[model samples]
Target chain A: MTDPTASAEPPSGPPARRRGRPSRAASAGTRDRILTAAREEFSAHGYDKTSVRQIAKAAGVDSALVHHYFGTKEQVFAAAVEVAFAPALAAPDTLAEGPADGVGERLARFVLGVWENPTTRAPLLAILRSAVTNETAAAVFRRLVAAQLVRRVAARLDLPDAELRAELAAAQLVGTALMRYVLKLEPLASADVEEIIARVSPVVQKHLTQP
Target chain B: MTDPTASAEPPSGPPARRRGRPSRAASAGTRDRILTAAREEFSAHGYDKTSVRQIAKAAGVDSALVHHYFGTKEQVFAAAVEVAFAPALAAPDTLAEGPADGVGERLARFVLGVWENPTTRAPLLAILRSAVTNETAAAVFRRLVAAQLVRRVAARLDLPDAELRAELAAAQLVGTALMRYVLKLEPLASADVEEIIARVSPVVQKHLTQP
Candidate 1:
């Protein structure tokens, strides 16, 4: 493991990479460490309160290194959001796996399934909380979700106003996540996962395919 | 220091509220003024940062009177949620207004319409932001929504697991609100209200009426 503070110990705080090229694997590892730390910080403190310095400290790196790697707090947050949403953004592909009639169920199950797992749920919730409260975070989030998930999902639909349809479908899943996971609204929160999948999948299906 | 004329009916008031102070009557106008101030405070500062003193100051009432009428800050928030949700909680009756197929559109329109109105949207957004971030806020929000809206709507549905169905339907609308209003995600955010109602109504119809 790289010494997180070694570079900063020098008079100039240039990242070790700037002094000399490190092994690609080591560089990737450092990047990953920073990202993990970013996720944890963002998840715990949210976007408005979390600072790059805090993330660097958490990762045992200098704040300059975080700037070197991610440019800004907003960028770091975007990167963190990307990691959390990567799997779910692949949802359009998931939707293609089953018959069109079952697409709604598959899509519903896919989105909710991501939330069902504890490990993934933390960062997603963190991203969502930040998005709701912070304007910058929300813009970054809206851009990614709009660009990555909604538009792609829209592309898959063979319908008029496909963008609207895709977003509406997104609204269904996002809302379910808020109620069941974020707010922990009862009935929805306590209801069986499969039962929810059974009930909501059809609604999703209609949004995706129906007129 | 009690102003007998200001609260002449305090001791024998029908409201029977006895928490903040005995300085004011639990008159509807005064109670509403406190609640309005509370909603504005909570909306602007969220649950954690807002205080009874601030709410009372905004309403030109004593803090003790706020406590008197609302008991605790949590109770005050519950009261605020009740006001914002008053019309929404009565959605069961709205469902009874039109033909079965049209129910979804009517419901969708009713909800988005609430959001469309500036006066209503602000407090709702504030309440939503608070609920998502604070545990007590979430509990109060969840309880109000579950008790007031979901269960009532569930009672209207003649289906098995009616409560679950009602909650699922709620997820759809809440998610849409998160996207369109809270996050203000594009496409969905800019889409015409009628268009949204058209797209989302059938989905609601399925959730409320279908097996």
Candidate 2:
């Protein structure tokens, strides 16, 4: 619920009756705006360089509002990561929809598609870049991937060493992303998404399915 | 050749006769010393945080000497990467010694071994951290991996999509390094070297040897 007092004090308008809590939509919108700005600032400046004041400024809100919403920069970052990786966090479910044999292709398609999409790729890149440099960010990132992404996929396999296999598959896909997206290594970077999926999916499939 | 002026000066000792250009070995030693200090400083502080003055102080030399040896911070970082990745840069030759099928195992063993070795891993970890955050460092790192490491392996493969395959193999290995060494992701981080070799080599083998 939005604070009634704050909602009632509108700029260039007479004070209206402070009715019941301002709409959930308005509160959620403010939270989303803060997160979007936080993602951009963190991505651009990394965890150490970014400040709450800067994020608040970027979001066009007061610093106190940011603190009120997110508590700390770390909390804000965690929320931002959650927002950025929401699609990827859901990607493990894609494993359930397809045949076991094609899980690798589906997985690869989903990951590469995320990287190829501007919407997902931007924040993911920022998180990735931050993770690489900042220990705190890296810890958060590790938990997200290991607990949420990799482990979830590992759960799908009805086999021994399922966790290891899932991680091996992650290593291949994450490695591909490191090179193609982050490092921008040529040929691989310039290669079509389809080509990458073709070459990489089998390896993923093999890692996931092989004994 | 080391500078005659620098070599003549000794701490708490009589000044030796100022000679002509110092021996190649002496000059090389200074360069190596500077690089070692650079690696340590860069590792501890990262690229943006590290300064030539600090590096020189760490190396027991003047900032001018650091500049004299490595030209700029970028050049110093390049030299440090070269030193850190020397063994890995030479890894392609290992493929030539063994049968083609075993190359994957050999490659995995060599890479994981490098990561496992604390002596090499320390500076490498620093370079990796720097590369993730600093664009300039990333460029140097990209050149080292693409030009010196991955491309060399691709050249040895002699396959139709040799470059792509080599990179895919690199992607897997690099990804593993990212997770295990950089991110310190669980299981993989603590996973036994041989166990990882057992699991990852086949995928590397597949990426490399497959049509």
For lDDT, the strongest prediction is 2
CA-lDDT, candidates in order: 0.81, 0.82
Question: Residues B54-99, candidate 1, lDDT per residue (tens digit)?
Answer: 9988987777667767778888899999898775766777877878
- Name the runs in model 1 displaced over 4 angstroms: A1-23, B1-30, B60-62
TM-score of candidate 1 versus the correct structure, residues matched by position = 0.87
lDDT of 1 at A83: 92
Tens digit of per-residue lDDT, candidate 2, span B166-185? 89998998899888887888
Model 2 bad stretches (over 4 Å): A1-23, B1-26
Q: Lowest-lDDT window of 10 residues in candidate 1 chain B? A: B7-16
Q: Native-contact fraction for each model?
A: 0.80, 0.77
